[model samples]
Target: MADSAPEVPAEERQEDPDVVDRKAEVLAEQIKKSKHFIVFTGAGISTSAGIPDFRGTEGVWTLMAQGRQRPSAVNTLQAVPTATHMALVELQNRGILKYLVSQNCDALHRKSGILPDRISELHGNNNREYYFRAVASYEKTVHDHRTGRKCVRCGGDLLDSIVNFGEYLPAEPLRLARNHAKKTDLCLVLGSSLTVPPASGIPETVGTRKAAKLVICNLQETPLDGLVDQRIYSKADELMTRVMAKLDIPIPQFILRRRLIVQMETTGGSRHQLKICGVDVDGTPMTFLRSIKLDQYCRRAACIEPFTISFRSDLDIGTELKLELEFMGNYGEPNLEIIYSYTGEAGTEMMYLLEYNPQTGEWKTERQESQSVDEDKKPTRRGR
Candidate 1:
């Protein structure tokens, strides 16, 4: 990133109403004519989708500078990508956009369907993994993080990719972004004021050095506006939707894809009861269930993990039984329901991974796992 500069204070500037459409047409033409389009983003691009920018009227830093506390808003854990994110994904999917460089730490770009390798997060991503401070790959016991488990080899802790104040951006992602920015022929700075150092200098570093056109779409003026070829003061979603419409490209809708894997671990005994638990792709536990219907043969008692049943004592382990269970997202982020049906005996123990396909409304089971029972897994735990 370029050296940090004095932060740009937020302000309002209205564009002429008649020139808006003309500017959109110009943008469409620029995009069509350019061979390589690189998109640089900031917090503003996500504001329309519910995340506030850092320098907007209601921006967090703006309010902080005014000697006021930032307003409470929805946390990033629940924030979904906006239309701008989807549009970029479409452009990249069609090969119109070559690369992505983002200063914001929000994980929306990856959530919006961009491949991890195609984009570089200059700041960092929230949904990321970290290695133990001293654990080797082979010695790193891979238990569900939901168990509050520590590294078995060294008892070390993993870390997230969040960069707090006074911390420098990670090196690898920053290098990747700089490489892409330098080679960009057409760069669109979206929803960013370009006030920060290093990153703020990218447009000039790439655009002017390579003789590329710099198109900036933001609500307020930025430090780099004087050098910009086209500056549109507007919301990110509004501007991108119009630009995509002008190009006759439809924004692809993102569908939620979930997976559910249910496993049963039996404690060896004469009358063994298999413990049951299932988790989604994100490691969220499966708790809620759809209405369960029972017949005369299978009499179910109060439902419990691994399912509690009070069938006749004669039908114990080794007796043929059928169990149909429906699991759903606990927090409702994934609203799809998952159904799993097993035709094993009452005490049949096996580790199964069920892939949930929300698009087709079916659960696909995979090959069985040959692992032993884990004593630490709890029904109340959340996945990491």
Candidate 2:
């Protein structure tokens, strides 16, 4: 689909290290002085993570345009967040970056620990699925945008959120990005060629402001190169690493943290149904676990979702039930186990927080009791 767009020359250029350091110092000062700072990202920021860019010399689109085979690369799920992504998270955590607008659908920003409310993904995320009114994560490989799942509440079909060629950009993310662009005093463009519109027009909106300062950091020539206050031809990771150091902020490491909800429902007598599934921070279904096995019993649930195992066990309360969890292993996570004591209580639920550090090859799990509340009751909104 990227080949459908006009072919631009994929010439890459890099500035000297000293020049990049000087520019980073100036950018650091700009961020410190600005009241509202925002960032816009493109595919270039993700190339360091084994993902291919669309306009680079060996980019996917460039190869397709030349009638060459697309380069073999890791799947988006397996790609880790780059230094640029981690730096942005640190900037947001320090309250320096007000908002983020990304054209990439890789979902790296979210995976980097940026809150969902702090970013607007205009092109949609490949890892996300949308029903008529709800959005959820789709961890498996998506084909034709059909996730083969339906909305639990309304039974509507769920479609992958990736925006294809000629499709309109998401309205909400686009509107929020434009609003941030209008309000930002300092606009930082990272890894974007500024070729696609009306997403590309967002940076122009800020550049046209009289008091706003726009900076572009990309190896390729962008249409906005002439309009920016500062232009640095460098990789996003290199530039961002230097900028963060200048600001005295350390880039945080990427940790794969997941929340799983384990619930046991008493069907009747000694029979019970045990269910285990992964969920996002917002309680949306996250398909991270590939399979679940019950130890001792030698039973396993390898189905798509709603992983459940029903059995009539006369085991008394306090007896431990061990469950082996096999994850998708995108980051080399090993098989984990969860030991749950038979409560024999109806409507019992527990929450487990699983964190894995790829750099350290360590895994940690914390269990907490799940508090159940009435769904019919009106919920109270809390400030972010």
Q: In candidate 2, what are the lDDT values of residues 1-384, reduced to their tens digit? A: 565644565679999999999999999999999999999999999999999998788888887777789868979898999999999998999899999999999988888888888999998887777665344355543335666676533356777788766777889889999999999999999999999889998899999998899999999999988889999999999999999999998999899888888877778887887778687776666778888988676455556466788878766788788888898888999988888777766676788999999998788999997655343541221100
Top of the candidates by TM-score: 2
lDDT of 1 by residue, 206-320 (tens): 6676468898888788878877788888777777888999999999775433333433323334333433444434443433443232333455532544344433234343344
In candidate 2, where is summed lDDT lowest over 10 consecutive residues? Answer: 375-384
**TM-scores of the candidates in the order shown:** 0.67, 0.89
Model 1, position 358: C-alpha lDDT score: 34
**Model 2, residue 56: C-alpha shift (Å):** 1.6
Global local distance difference test of model 2: 0.83
> How displaced is residue 69 in candidate 1, in Å?
2.7
lDDT of 2 at 321: 80
Residue-level lDDT for 326 in candidate 1: 49
